[model samples]
Target: MKISMTVNGKPVSAEVEARTLLVTFIRENLRLTGTHVGCDTSQCGACTIHLNGRAVKSCNILAMQAEGADIVTIEGLAKADGTLHPMQEAFREHHGLQCGFCTPGMVMSAVDLVKNHPNPSEETIRAELDGNLCRCTGYHNIVKAVKAASAKM
Candidate 1:
């Protein structure tokens, strides 16, 4: 199958197998390994990415489903000049990640949440992020990072 999409800000086109997962296409075909695949069953949000500005678990979607969509991964969150996004800076400042496996998804989800609710309360942040699991930070710092990012936004 031939897939065409805008990834990270660059237009990309590739012929892929019908069975190829979106995560596999991103990491293998496009060489964007920042989107991790912790669980292929979609239980883990490690493979999250932005599809048309909304966060989705790439592991659950086939590459063909993403054809012609606008996709954004962790690698695309930074400014073209290399400066980190406010969320990325907040995560770093607040120590939101430990093992770093869940950071990409967490950041992606955080970006979406903040976009919708720029001043989200702690409880709202927690409830919104219930789907994305972080085994390392105990979620305390992750919440702080979201709050911090929200303030910046």
Candidate 2:
């Protein structure tokens, strides 16, 4: 099957198998390695990306399902000159990541949350981020990063 979509602000098309997961297509076919595949199951949001401007776990969807859609990975969030996105900056400043395995998805999801709730409380942030699992950071600094990014926005 051939899938075509806008990815990271660029139009992309590729031939993929029917069973190809969106994450595999992004990381393997598109060579966008920033979207990590931490878990094959959808429990981990390590492969999360914005599907039509909303966050969705790429591991849970087929590449064919993403055809004709707009997808934004962590690589697309930075400025053209390579400056970090506000959420990325906040994560760096607040030490939100330890092993860095979950940083890409965490930052992407945080950006989405802040967009939906510009001034989310700590509790709300925690609730919204419940689906994203991070084994290294314990989520303390992650929540703080979201708050800091919210303030900047």
Candidate 2 Cα outliers beyond 4 Å, as residue runs: none
| Poorly placed runs, candidate 1 (over 4 Å) | none
lDDT of each: 0.93, 0.93
Q: Give the per-residue Cα lDDT of candidate 2 at 3.
A: 83
TM-score, candidate 1, is: 0.97
Worst 10 residues of 1 by lDDT: 129-138
1-153 per-residue lDDT for model 2 (tens digits): 878999999999998899999999999998999998988799889988999999999999999999999999999999999999989999999999999999899999889999999899999999999879998855999999999999997
TM-score of each: 0.97, 0.97
For model 1, residues 85-150, the per-residue Cα lDDT tens digits are 999999999999898989999999899999998799999999999879887755999999999999
